[model samples]
Target: MKFVIYKDKLVESVQNVSKAVSSRTTIPILVGIKVVATDEGVIFTGSDSDISIESSVEKHENDQINVEVIQTGKIVLHARFFSEIVKKLPDKQVEIEVTDNFHTIVRSGKAEFNLIGLDAEEFPRLPEIEEGLSFQISNDLLKTIIRQTVFAVSTAESRPILTGVNWVIEKDLLTCIATDSHRLALRKAPISINPNKSFNVVIPGKSLTELNKLLDDNQEPVEVVFMENQIVFKTKNLLLFSRLLEGNYPDTSRLIPDESKTELTLQTKEFLQAIDRASLLAREGKHNIVKLSTLTNNTVEISSTSPEIGKAVEELQLERVEGEDLKISFSAKYMLDALKSLEEQELTISFTGAMRPFILHSINDQSQIQLILPIRTY
Candidate 1:
């Protein structure tokens, strides 16, 4: 393989694809990146089975030439060392050549490095996805959906299915829900597409998090194509494929209470800060629990007590309070995460009692809701 490419373009491609490279893999070749030089451009691929990222440095984009392929060939170079070398190369352009015997030479400016390259045939083939189901969404919107719910996925391996976010599409509305048993985050947006198609899928939280990093806050559209087992995300010159999680994601619809005994409307930022302060004392407690009690008609008291450490108490005057006065204790972390996901300035929290899970939502937006299971802080 031989190619001469601008150093900046090459560096960017390598850094982007490196998100998929895994060092602790059973397949030794998975630790390296597949660099394919063709007549059109240079393609870099990094994968570790679950996810793969393919980024290309095209010959010309927006009237700019980024790569010139001298010889059509393919080679796999160590991802870690090669990426670092490309970044530090003191030249405007990089020249790479691979011999038939797998010996590779990378040269830029006055620095030259020769590393053994692996046969590209050894790299695992990316899954071939046929046209099954597809839709287009704005990149900015997809990133927002990911950020709003990915944080709530369970980190424990006990319930493997809970480690992913449940995505359900019924007509034009797409809903994403994630929970770790303690806290749940949910987001919904109307997709601009045909309203006849319906689909349900579970995607790993880690995969969505990785895709979020690759997406810029740009105004371009992303094409999402999903089959029975794999999903593809395409935008510009980037293509990302991730395997779908199997098994029935527990029906969480019933878990969210339909009625509430107490409802409190408060400023989102103020409530978050109150929980933040309460958490400081609760951090030393067993469950990091914070208690919220309605002290007066519209005044809510937020307090936390640690047997060994001091206690914290703060009063938050709510914009409105209805239903019944209540007191409940839940993980401060859970409440904080749920509060941060809201885009509105004001929020309404519904409590079904001190034991049942509480629900949170924007004051005006009922499409997105968060649930937090209260902790027994006796």
Candidate 2:
């Protein structure tokens, strides 16, 4: 493969595709990046079985030349070494050439490196997805959905299915639900495409997190293709192929309580601060449990007691309180994560009781909700 490319553009493409390169892959060739230079552009692909990322550096765009392909060919280069060398290149242009025997040379300025390249034909070919189940979503909205829900997925391997976020689509609504059994996050948004199509899938949390980092927040719409066992996220100059998690995601509808015994509207920032202070003491208790009790005059007390450590108590005045007075205990970490993920300034908290899970939602927006199961610290 022979290509002379702008160093800056080459570095960007290399770094983007390197996200999927894994050092522990069973396939030897999977440890390296497959580079293919064609007349139109230079494509870099990296994969580690579960996920694959492909990034492209076009020859030119908008009257600006990015790369010149001298001899169209393909080769696999060590991802770690290639990425590092590209980043530290001393010149504005990079020249790469791969001989017929798979010998490679990279040059820029006065520095030149010789590498033994692998035959690209040996690299695993990505599945040819002919399925027609595809949809288009705004890049920003998709990123928001992943950010708001992926955090709540279980990290434990005990329940493998819980390690992924459950995505359900009905008509034009797309709902994402994630939980570790201790805390749950739910978000909903409108899907303008494939309104008549309906399907449920469990997307690995780690995949979503990586894809979110690679995706850019642009006004353009990205195409999402769903296959029998794979999901593809395609954006301009980038593509992410992720395997779908097998097994059924538990139905979470029954977990949320229909009625609440207590409801309170409070300033999100103030309540979060109070909880933060209480968590300092709560952490000493191992459980990181913080207690919230209703007080007089539309006020609530946030407190934590560590037995070995002293207690922390803070009062937060609420905008409104209704239903009944209540006291609840929950994990400080979970509480903080749920609050930070929300975009609302004012939140309405509903408590069923000290034992049942409590729910938080924006006063104006009901589409997104966070649920934290209370701790038994009576």
Candidate 3:
């Protein structure tokens, strides 16, 4: 395959698709990126079986030609070397030409390199997801939903299902839930779409994390297509495919409390900063635990103690405190994560009791919620 591509455009597309190429793949060919040049434009594909990414550099977009095709063909080059070489090439443009024997040459301003390429025919084909179930969501909103929940997915592979985020779409609302048994994150967003379709799919947390990195914080819509075992995300010039985990995601609806016995409203940033300071001492402790107690003076006390080191105590003034006063201990790391995901200035934390899981969310935003299981510190 022979083609001339703009260096900046090529670098960006390569960097994007490279996220899916795993260096330790058993299949040697999987270590390379497949480039296909056609009359339309150039397409780059990277995959490691679990996830696949396809990005194209079209001939013209927004009235610009990013690629000029000299000849139409296909080739596969080592992903790591090719990507590094392209990015560092000392030119504004790159010319790639492949021979019939799969020997590829890369040339730029005063620099040339030749590498053995593989036959693109051996690459695995992306699953053609027929119109099964689909939805559209803004890129920024999707990124928000992913960041809010993916952190809670189980890192332990003992129960593989818990390693993925469960997505449930009904009517105009989409709900995303993730849990590691100790804590949970749930986010809901209303999206406009065709009526009468509901979807339940468990996508790996790793996949969602990758997708998050690929998305730009824009208002453009991302089209999602789900088949029996695969989910595809379509953007302007990119297509991302992830295999769905096989198993029923545990029902987490009942775990979230429907009512609270004690509720406290505090500034989100204030609470976050208090936890951040308290965690320094907690980090020295074996369990990294912090104690939170609602005080009678409309303040929440954040404290942590380590037997061998020291202790930290800080008070954060609250906007309001209601119901019964409560004292709870939980992982400071979990609390910080929940706090970082909040896009609000004020937050409300609801505690059912000192023993049960407590909930944290934006004061006026009910669509996003974070729950933390208390740590036993007797």
Candidate 4:
């Protein structure tokens, strides 16, 4: 294969696909990136078994020439070397050529390097998911959904299913839920889809995290395709494939209480800041617990205490408080994360009781919900 590609564009494409490159793999060939040159453009692919990424540099884009093909072929070069060499090249453009024996040469300005590549045919084939159950979501919205929920996925591997974000698609509405037993995040958004289309899939949290980095914040739609065991996210110049986690995701709806005994409406930022300050002392505690109590003055006191560290206390005026008086203790870190995920200025936090889980939902946005189980501190 021989092609001349714009250096800046090539660097970007290489880095994007390299996110899927495997650091440890039983198959040695998987360590390299497969580059394919055709009349249309040059394609780059990288995979670590669980996730695969394919990106291309078109020969022509927006009337500008990005790549000029000298010959059409394919080769697999060591990603560690190829990526580094591409970035360090001293010219605005790079020329790559391969021989019949899989020997490759890279040139830029006055620098030229020779690399031995592997046969492209030996690389595993990417999954061909038939476009049956598919939908489109805006790039920014998709990233928002991921950001709001992925953080709550369990880091523990004991319950492998909990390590992923559960996606439930019914008609045009898509719901995403993630929980680690102690906390949960749920987001809902409308998508472009057929009314009869319904799907429930668990996508590995790690995969969504990586995919989020590559997605640009724009109104451009990202096409999502669902298959039996794999899910594909297709953008203009890229295709991302991730294997769905096997097993049924627990029914999380039952965890959210339908009613609340104590409801408090307050400024999201004010509460978030107060908790942030109290967490200084809370961090020194065993479970990083922060205690909250409703005061008779229609205000609330946020405090934390550590036997060896110290204590922190602050009281903030609430917009409104109703139902019952309450005192609850929860992880400071969890509270901060849940509050940060919200974009609203004011939110309502409802407590079923001191022991049951409490939920935080924005007054203006009912589509997002954050629930956290209270920590016991007797």
Candidate 5:
């Protein structure tokens, strides 16, 4: 393949596609990026069996040429070396050409490098997903949903299905939920476009994390196409495909209590800070646990005790406290994570009891909920 491309566009495309390149793959070709030059534009593809990313640089956009293809061909080059070389090119333009026997030459400014390229045919083909169901969501909203729930996915491999986030769509509503057994996060959003059928799928948490980084915080709509086993996220010039995790995600609906015995409303920032300070002493202990107890005069006492270290206690005024008195202990890390994901100034925390999980919801937005299982401390 021979093409002369603008350095800025080339670098961006390479960097985005490189996210899918596998460094420890048994297949040597999976470590290389396949570059194809056609009449339409130049496409860069990277895959590691689980996820694949393809980024395209059009020949001309808005009457400005981004990539000028001299010949229509294809080649695969080492992803790591090629990305580094393109990023450090001295000039604004780079010329790449592949000759007989897959010999490649990359030139820009006064620097030149000869790389041994592999036949593009060796690269594994991306799964051909039939577009059975599709929908669109604002890029900004999708990123928000991912950030709120992906953190709660289980890191342990004991329950492989719990390592992914569950996505369920019914009618025009989409709900995302993730849990690690100790805590859970849930987010609900309205879909702009309704699919022909409903879907319940588990997507790997790591895939969503990488895809979230690629999305820009904009109002532009991103097209999502879902197949039986694969899902494709398409934006302006980029496409990301991820394989769905196999297995049935456990039913978590029953895990959330329908009613609470106690409810407390407080400033989100104040509560978060109190937990942050209380966790300092808790971190030194065997379990990073913090205790919260309702006090008189509508205040909550946050404290932590460690045998080797001293104790920390702070009283914070609550906006409202009602129902039965409550005292609970939970992982400070889990509480902080759930609190940080909220964008509200005020929050309502509901407790079923000292032994059951507690729920948190934003005062203004009821679409998202966070639940944390209390840690038992005698």
Candidate 6:
């Protein structure tokens, strides 16, 4: 393909599409990016078997030429090398031309390089997903939901389903849940537009993590299209496709207790800081466990002890403490992760018992819930 394009726009598009490129792919063509120049614009595509990304650079936007097409053609160049070349190009414009036998030349400023390109026909076609179930959500809100839950997905492959975040949409509300058996995160938000049918799907945490990075923190709406096995996320100039994980996500509703034996309300920041300090000592222990115990006069004691290191004890004043007296031990790392996901002035933590899982929720927001199982310290 022969085209002249703005350097910054091309760089951004290349960087985005490169996220789907797999370094260990058995298919040699998958290591390269496919570029197609047409009358409309230039399209760049990158894909492994699991995920694919396509980004377009229009010929002209707002009466300014973004791309000047010299000829309509297609070629594939090594993704890694091409991306590096584009980034280091000395000029604001880049000219790319493919000649006979797929020999490509890239030129910018005083630098020019000849690269052996592959036939674009060898690249796998992107999944053709017919628009079936679709919805729109604000980009910023989607990023928030991912950040709150994706961290809790299991990194191990023992239970493959736990490696993905579960998404369920009913009526006008969307709920996202992630858990690694030790800790769980759940967040719910109201959907601005609802589809005709409910959707229950498991999306790999890795995919969501990558997609989250591509999304900008803006109020613009992102369109989502759902098919049988693939999900598509689309913006103005970008299209992202990810294969859904196959398997029924375990039902986690029953894991949360109906009632609590002990309930405590405290400033979220104070509690987080106390746990942060206590974890310094707990790090020397076997499991990094921290103990929390209710004290008299609406206060709680956070403490950790390590025989090899030292002990840390801090008293945090609570806004309210009720129900039964309690002492619970849990992983300080897990507690810190759960607490950091929340942005609230105050939070309420409820303990079912010393052994059962406890839940943390914002005092003002009931849409999110974090649960952590206690660790036994003997």
Reference-based TM-score of each model? 0.97, 0.98, 0.98, 0.98, 0.98, 0.97
- Each prediction's RMSD over C-alphas, in Å, is 1.3, 1.2, 1.1, 1.1, 1.2, 1.3
Candidate 3 on 117-201: residue-level lDDT in tens? 9999999988876875677889999999999999999999899999999998888788999999999999999876554578788
lDDT per residue (tens digit) for residues 1-378 in model 4:
799999998899889889999879898999999999999999999998899999999999999999999999999999988999999999999999998699999999999999999999999999787968888888999999999999999999999999999999887789999999999999999877754677899999999999999999999999998877999999999999999999999999999999999999999999999999999988887899999999987899999998998889999999999999999999999999999999999999999999999999999999999999998875
The C-alpha stretches of model 4 lying farther than 4 A from their native spots are: none
Better of 1 and 2 by TM-score: 2
- Candidate 1 — what's its lDDT? 0.90
Question: In model 5, what is the error at residue 228, expressed in angstroms?
Answer: 2.0
Instruction: Evaluate all candidate structures by whole-model CA lDDT and list the values in order.
Output: 0.90, 0.91, 0.92, 0.94, 0.94, 0.93
Show the lowest summed lDDT stretch of 10 residues, model 2: 190-199
lDDT of 5 by residue, 1-378 (tens): 789999999999999999999999999998999999999999999999899999999998999999999999999999999999999999999999999999999999999999999999989888775765888999999999999999999999989999999999987889999999999999999885444567899999989998999999999989988877888999989999999999999999998989999999999999999999999999998779999999999999999999888999999999999999988999999999999999999999999999999999999999999999998874
Model 3 residue 79 distance off true place after TM-score fit, in angstroms: 0.6
Per-residue C-alpha lDDT of model 1 across residues 1-378, encoded as one tens digit per residue: 788999999998899899999999999999999999999999999998999999988899899888889999999999999999999999999999998689999999999999999989999998776765777999998998998899999999999899999988887889999988777888988875543588889999988999999998988999888876888898888888898999988888888999999988889999999899999999998788999999776999999999888888898899988888787899898888888889899999999998999899998898789999998864
Residues 99-175, candidate 2, lDDT per residue (tens digit)?
Answer: 86899999999999999989899999988866587889988888888988999999999999999999898887889
Off by over 4 Å in 6: 192-195
Task: Work out candidate 2's RMSD over C-alphas.
Answer: 1.2
Given candidate 4, what's the lDDT at residue 2? Answer: 94
Alpha-carbon deviation at 89 in model 4, angstroms:
1.2
By lDDT, is 3 or 5 better?
5
CA error at residue 332 for candidate 2, angstroms: 0.6
